[model samples]
Target chain A: MLVTKWVHVPEKAINKPRQIEQDGVKFTQSISPWDLPQQFRFLIDAESLTIEWRYLSDSEPVKRKEFPDGFAVELGKTSSRIYKITVSLSALEKSISVMPTDEAEAATSALIKMKNALAEIENYPNENNKVAMTKTAHWWANLPNKAELLANAM
Target chain B: MLRTSLAVYGWLNWVARGYQRASSYIASSCGFFLLIDTEKSEFLSTRPVITKFVQEIQSNMFILFCLFLFLAVIAHILTKKTSLDVWKEIKFILDRYQEKCFPNNKEKDLHRVTLFRLEKHCLFRRHWSSRNWLNFRGHCRLFSNFLVPVLRSGHINGKSNTFFQVGSDQNYEGVAGLAFRQKSQVAVKNLPDLSSPLMAKVKDRKRLITEYALQTNCKRELIEKWVELGKTVPRSIAATPVEVNGQIWGVLVLDSTSPETLSSESVSDYTVVIAVIGKLLERM
Candidate 1:
């Protein structure tokens, strides 16, 4: 029994919700936290080992596009393996074979630590992450056109 | 987005079909009789023919009325029935949102909530169950707007609670107040303590918790009265507490008119979802 009420929208100020449906992928203005990027890592290749940074730079976004919902756990584990192969192959092309599992573990641990750090940012308005939390909350709360409205068939 | 579009289309289709049906009913109920009456008037001098035509029209009209009554009654009966599990339907939407939020992470839907009795004032009842307070506390108004009716009309969703704490001073004052107490200020207060009754039902911990409304042992008289007075449906519910960092925070209640809303699989899923929320709340 949700009744529809008519409210006038200013001709100039009205911002109809934007729907993205053309790129073989569709997402509404609703944003989910998983869509945001977190986790960071650094690595130094040994004297005989070389690092290939482009594996992440070139492929991760493409992979994300392919699976906008994000990787399933099995897919994530597979992604790590795929990235590892590319890293190994690229490094081998330049005469490096040895890789460290430490970076992945560190990245995960860091992600957890980062979530803990950022989770309370809203409580502390003066904190540096407040701006980020504001943006995040704004993103969540600001999905366009929350009004119960849709096309009415006459 | 697709759901919103489909809902609009579905509603439009329903309305259009109803209109078409009404037109057919009018035609059948009146059009044939009118045509017969006009032809009979033209044969006024022919007594035998007029008499035969009148008999034919009378019998046809009688049959038409019977069909109309039967169809209307059957349609009403069908409309009264519900096939939807509201929580499950909602969870599907939540799952979609969850996937979007943590694309790589799979999370559980909340099934079980811990129940604890509050000492002083209870909005609907004293013992309340919760999973997370963030949803009910912060965005309750939004949920109330979007989800209230959706949950209310569910086949098994008549008694769902998504309550948050609103201390005595803030009765009808804050966000939680507007969400839970907005229905009828007087009616919401003084309801039987939901906790004591539910606590008794779940006392053995040995007998698996089933839907309370269906249990012969549970007294839902007050709750049912409250719903009736509020002009809402009766509810059989599953309420759980939200535990964060080993401390109880809030409650989550999922209820339906029928006691059979939460399946075993859904309960498991709910456990996972609630636990995940508990962790998230601990950080907050």
Candidate 2:
């Protein structure tokens, strides 16, 4: 069975510090959240999953990657932004089978609904969609242990 | 107590009588009474010497009362000035918050500005009178399960003045993680137990983890690594969960090298400040 889930990456994960050597002078620079994509679509099958992501501001072609079986796709480090799928490969390899079938399906459905709601808000900026967006943000912010909880559950 | 007071009073009376007799003898020896009229002198002699002594004591008591009153007034003024200064500092912080966080009535980078304002203005800039606390660090960890240092204030290695840094990720450990887990404020005066034996230290560590509801494997080794890297391991730490819309969005943490620099009572201001930041975050 093909299961799909949409993820909204929190801004914290994308904003990371990197050391840059310019003209032999080393300085730490942070990757801005604006420079990274904050949303992704995870396409999961029985043995592998593909992650598709794109920047919000650009009309560029979406980037896609596939991981073998035993790989997991969930929230990124710091419970925030999701930059890529490979970051958590080693950490989540064993937890993929831990999630029950029914719960995984339920979580996928809820995530799909949330993605739709967010899309609606983007398209129509109406009061109802704004309310829905607020609710979604609230729910997302409160799920602090989303990655670990999902890994354990899976 | 009453009997003791009466005894003291009688002793004073005896001393006063002796003083009076000495004064009378001196006056007689000086022959000062020869110049006065006998009748007037007789009247003066009839006056109780104790009355004069009591009068002198009353005058000294009045002088002491005056001094006490002067001190009381000075103390009152000083206290008033201190309170006024605190209020002024709070107002100044609020003003800075408005200017920095919500420039042009909009927040461009909400988290960065919030953490910067708190670190620069509230925690370090306020009347935090401790030299050891001069290196106070303010950091905000935005995730509950895994603490991530999104922004930090104060000096690290005497460089990197900017508040934005992607520091190492931490699990539910230390004061910040404990605060996140507890959903409230958590503060520890001291962190290490270097004086204890190895076995006792292990037991203490376990007890502390259980007591504070922190994750296993105390972050002391990590702190030691930091120390090796020229970073000071905090002696005191306080963390408060930043709640946005009734859900904890993250945690605001402050650490100092001085023990007892932060406590539950001292962190109330921090809580208020974090709460305000949370409300602002909700708007964002």
Candidate 3:
């Protein structure tokens, strides 16, 4: 049987910037229509991402927009997805995508580090099956124990 | 001997006086001939007339000054000069085109001469019709800079209507219809691949593309093309879609021989112009 260890994992990114069409979202209800700006509320989940727009009443939604597999999310970094939308009357279609600069950059750097760590782990020794038994040292106090374990194993 | 010397000096003075009178008479006569010849021969077209006129003015300032004053007064009285609306420094451009085409109905005279000259060369009609100007209607002629004749000399001076088929967007057929009418002298090229992902991105964006008119809603063909090094001529080719009530009705296309006139910025810069045209077209 394997042994267990205690560690503290840091907080993750749960909320992200909303990505809409570059022209922004517009709604047209009338026959001879003028473009109307839309106000939206976002609800993102594991399976789908949903956006709801209200007309006159606040409690209920007149329009509900849903996407099943467009977005990919990680803890701190951002990924972009394309969304195609069609206006009902005119059949005017548009595609909107997102580009988040700063967090995306940070996430990219973190991903690079994770990849490098994975490469190092792949080249690690075959002797003690060290990685299988180890956990990330999250505090300074845990460093000595982690080092001692490594020393013993070596 | 002193008496003989005096007589010789007197004779020389008479000869000099006669020579001066002859020279003055010749100069005045030459000036008079040119002013009259301007009506008949191509002598006024070759630019040396200005230099000769200046020389005549220098030789006889008072006569030329009176002539200039009289002409200026006549021009002031007769010329219904188009002013830059609401007092601006832009009075000059309209004046140049006006001067080229007007001033004592000189445009009509020039048109007549050109018709006479190109009698054999006039490939199209009997007289040039301002078809583009007609379609645009009313003071929309103020934006007449965009109407381009396909042939370099397809001026209002040329015979009959130019065969370039300078029509409205109602006749925009598939693939080179306009340029073919121009006999490949000019062409507006639009890519057929609307399905490309890049094309979708472009179409989704709001900006106008100069080279690609059929893509966007604006209707101006790019005329200036690439700005060359030397003299700047006004060209007014651009394309913008006429959007009425948030729907694209048609394209407002501008075509001008002068290439500098139309650009993407031409369409972008003149949103009000396009908007006004769109609203007017909607009303139509």
Candidate 4:
């Protein structure tokens, strides 16, 4: 099952808790990847066991990476135009990522997501990883140019 | 006297008709009154009285008509004089503003002559406001999404004030936002009271709206966070969208503490000022 939701974060509320509702479930956390205001679309894939977030302005994924049996989280401060966060899902209960002082809260929230996703995967591991990967690849290939379509509509 | 004379003359005419008939009968029977010529006598006697009465009425009517015409001309002149005086003053200020701000047609740097400085030089606040308490605020259109306030001028309690932050931006919200969205001038003679129960009901129980809730459409919670914002919500607001090169570039907003300060009649004057501003911006 694949579900998508849009999240709009208003400007200048750095310390406020953000609530995200996916499908029928709700996730309450203080997860602010970027300090700047932006709108994002979350693609939640249960079969591939991946959560891909894309920026609305330029339909680009933040980042994507694979981890070993333990979930891997990477955090860095880069001078890129857009901020990026890479998280890998596995059965690991711990995260190995340095948290910057200014973004410690956001980093912690990212780690919490990693642990929660890892726990879920452990409980229900994909029976056929090959099939899931093939489906995910096909889904990515068939993705539309949403940003361009939105601009044209406007 | 005229009425009495008219009554007496009418009675005499009636008697003359009867007398003339009797005289004709007598002249035909006895030939004694034939030399009298009753027909001629009757007409000659009544002609002068009728002509004098007509002249008197005509003279009185002519005098009344002339008097009314004279008063109408005087009233028209007085009205024009007052409006012409205001128009002359407005033109003088606008001319002075252009001369002072852009002397010798020298274009100043945009950064050097900021919107605040432009507003100060414009002198519209002093000219438009009867009480000289009008505030002039300027906003620049940003990316077609936001109206960022570049300059805001006003006082609080008869002292210099710094309330709204300089770079705060708004979307389609206030009278200025309405003007920006509509790409035209918008004037509100009196703003509704947002704190009133009627407004709260209209807002669907959103009672926490800001003091600028009605005037500026700013939220109360946001105002609290900003702290110094919207200490004095204006009672009246007038906004004109400034166009540069046929495209809306920004908005010029004027507000006053008293109701009806900035009215629809003032929108034309503001439009003239905004035209000059647009040209100045183009030069810059």
Candidate 2: the clashing residue pairs are: A10-A80, A10-A81, A98-A154, A99-A153, A99-A154
In model 2, which regions exceed 4 Å deviation? A1-154, B1-145, B155-171, B193-217
A1-154 per-residue lDDT for model 4 (tens digits):
3223443333223223334332222222221122122443322222122233232122222333345543343211221112233333223222323222212222233434543444455433221222222232333234354334223322
Better of 3 and 4 by TM-score: 4
Which lDDT tens digits does candidate 1 get at residues B1-284? 23444455456556555755795767675665655654446565467776676667676786866776676665554344232323334445434433432234222232212222222332223222223553333322221211111222212323344333344433222112222222100001111233333435545321322222223122244334333354333223333343443333443333223334332223323344545544444443
- DockQ per candidate: 0.03, 0.02, 0.01, 0.01
Index of the highest-DockQ prediction: 1
Q: After TM-score superposition, what is the CA distance of residue B101 in candidate 3 from its true location, in Å?
A: 19
> Distance (Å) between predicted and true CA of A64, model 1?
20
Error (Å) of candidate 2 at residue A71 is 50
Q: What is the lDDT, from 0 to 100, of the residue B43 in candidate 2? A: 58
- Tens-digit lDDT track of model 4 for B1-284: 22244345556555555554454453354333224343356653668766565445444655645764565454444434342343234334444443443344332221011121112122222211123243333332222234444433211122222222212253344555565544444556455444345643635434434334544544345433333343444556656665544345566655554555455444443333555555555544
Q: Distance (Å) between predicted and true CA of B112, model 4?
A: 21
Better lDDT candidate (2, 3): 2
Q: Is the docking of candidate 4 incorrect, acceptable, medium or high quality?
A: incorrect
Model 2: per-residue Cα lDDT at residue B128: 14
* Cα deviation of B146, candidate 3, in Å: 20
lDDT of 1 at A33: 15
